[model samples]
Target: MTSPASSKRPLWIVAATLLLGAAALWGGSRLVWSAQQRDGGVRGMLLETQTGAQHSGALVPLAVLAVAGVAGAVATGGWPRRVLGVVLAVAGLWACWIAVDGVSFSGFPPGAPVWQMFLGRALTLLAGILVLLGGLIATKRAGAMPRLGARYAAPSVKKTARDPDTELWEALSEGEDPTDSA
Candidate 1:
């Protein structure tokens, strides 16, 4: 007995999850790559220092959180969905923190392009907020909503086209006990 509203919730959740995940991935990559190319020659190109030591950024954790958020959205049952919501919210908060830290650089270094830094941080912050909102919505609706898989399940085919005798025989052949009474 799935309602239209109930089915639509999961679809919204899935869409939000995907959008947030993509934003996080893109922003985090930009931040990390921008940092790596900060000291490069001509328009922040990495050609001059391609063999230089690479600096690791917050991209890894951000990616992990995005993956978890998506997994949680796809998971079955209330508890799992709620847990995933919490995870996504936390990830969003973490992304916000990283963005803030990046933007808080005291001195603007010549090597580091200000525009890229701000753009990356801004995207991360926006993505984090969106993800957080999505997570909260998921958490609130999870208890009352049907599992994502169950909601999309195909309806059972009616056997109105079959004769009663044939149906009974088919049922019995499928290991339904004939002597069993309801």
Candidate 2:
């Protein structure tokens, strides 16, 4: 039997997963591809260049987070769902660690403020958290909920006219005085 709440839960989970995936993708791109400017000239002229090697390495974790988000979003039921949840949680933690590490490394150009450097990593971390939450929610709900196919399944109830002998036996079993009643 399907309840309104049961049906709605997965939808919300999927939505959250998608949102997280998008955020991770966007943040990862920013962290990986965006360059910052540094003041080098007498008049405070700035030059734009790619981020340093330390920040560049963060891309791998962000990519893992993005993949986990998508996998968590699509996975359904049983061990598969549980596995995805675990994956999401681990990926989120990994991304968070990498992002936080990036914050401490003074790799970006001087003109880029600490907050600016942290923004993309922060978003990546946030996306990882969302993915982890969604995966766990889905796993917790999966056990109590029936599968999609179960909704269509119904016990085959065969209805037939009551037999005379069966009715008489039922009356006798109940200690009913059928003859006296007549």
Candidate 3:
């Protein structure tokens, strides 16, 4: 028999991982990933900058999915949770790929701030890994997670009112005179 604490551990892990992953994704998206110098024919050299969001549109969606995964873990169980977990995992994998690709296509110029580019990519990668871990665990142990409003679940058994007619027929069948009481 699995203890409640043991079962709840996965839920905690899932919540933490999902929340952290989403944070990373959202943070990375806001960072400047790449910069470039543009030659102005009539003017001067103009610098251009690109961000993680500008690189790929998937970052925000992946982040949102991670957040939603946390909620789904809390609110759902059984097959629905499993499906959500699988989707979260897939989104994380996709984010990882996108992060790598964005960095590869950066085309950093000489003396470019490579740190920013790598940092953003690293954060995105970390987010993906965290979400992936959470998703896998959620899929495997969804039943153990707490459901929404679990504390207020209705009782499994309830007392129903006895019918007078049924009682009378039962007494008669048992050869007891229903009208006899001294």
Candidate 4:
């Protein structure tokens, strides 16, 4: 028998995964853009700083996360989905760490002011945490998908027609009031 809740699980997972992916993309693009705004360009400004390297490394993990999210949206069950979920979660954690470190490192220069550095770091940290949590939830939902899919994948139950309407009609025919305000 397919329970209504179980049947809806796949749709929910797909929707959640897609939403997470879209959010990550938006946040990531904004982070990169902000860094570019500070440095003037995406490719030329980051070779001299530790934060640059960390931020650069974030791209790969972000790619992995995007791919995994897309995959989860497209395919909700099986081992591939499980593997992707784990990868997405790990990537999310790594991204968070990089953001935190980058934010801290940005303030340690002779040119950069302390307030601006701290503010950038705080924003990065907040975004990182959001991405991390979203990825983690995506992972958890992926884990639940297989169980839900398996449960609902079972053969459907053929219910007998012992419906309330039929019973009511039979009661009325027998001179008994079916709707006696009971």
Best by TM-score: 3
Clashing pairs in 2: none
Per-residue lDDT over 1-182 for candidate 1, one digit per residue giving the tens place of the 0 to 100 score: 77878766764775466476556655555553233334455555552221001223555566666665666676655788888777777766766665565345545444656565566667766766766776676677776655657845654774452777887785675678756778
Give model 2 RMSD, 1 decimal: 10.8
Across 1-182, the per-residue lDDT of candidate 2 in tens digits comes to 78978776675665567466556645654653245665677857675634422455655555555555554445455676666667666665665565566355656555555564566666666665666566566556656533445554543663343997776675665568556756
RMSD of each: 6.7, 10.8, 8.2, 10.5
Colliding pairs, model 4: none
How many backbone clashes can be found in candidate 4?
A: 0
| Candidate 3 structure, TM-score to reference | 0.78
Better of 2 and 4 by TM-score: 2
Backbone collision count in every prediction?
Answer: 0, 0, 0, 0
Write down the worst ten-residue block by lDDT for model 4.
29-38
Models sorted by lDDT, best on top: 3, 1, 2, 4
88 in model 1: Cα distance from truth in Å?
A: 1.3
Report the candidate with higher lDDT, 1 versus 4.
1
Model 4 alpha-carbon miss at residue 101, Å: 1.6
| TM value for model 1 | 0.62
TM-score of each: 0.62, 0.56, 0.78, 0.46
Give each model's whole-structure lDDT: 0.60, 0.58, 0.85, 0.52
* Tens digit per residue, CA lDDT, model 4, 67-169: 5565564555656665665666666566556556534344343443445434444544454554455555555555454443464453465334498998788
In model 2, the number of clashes is 0
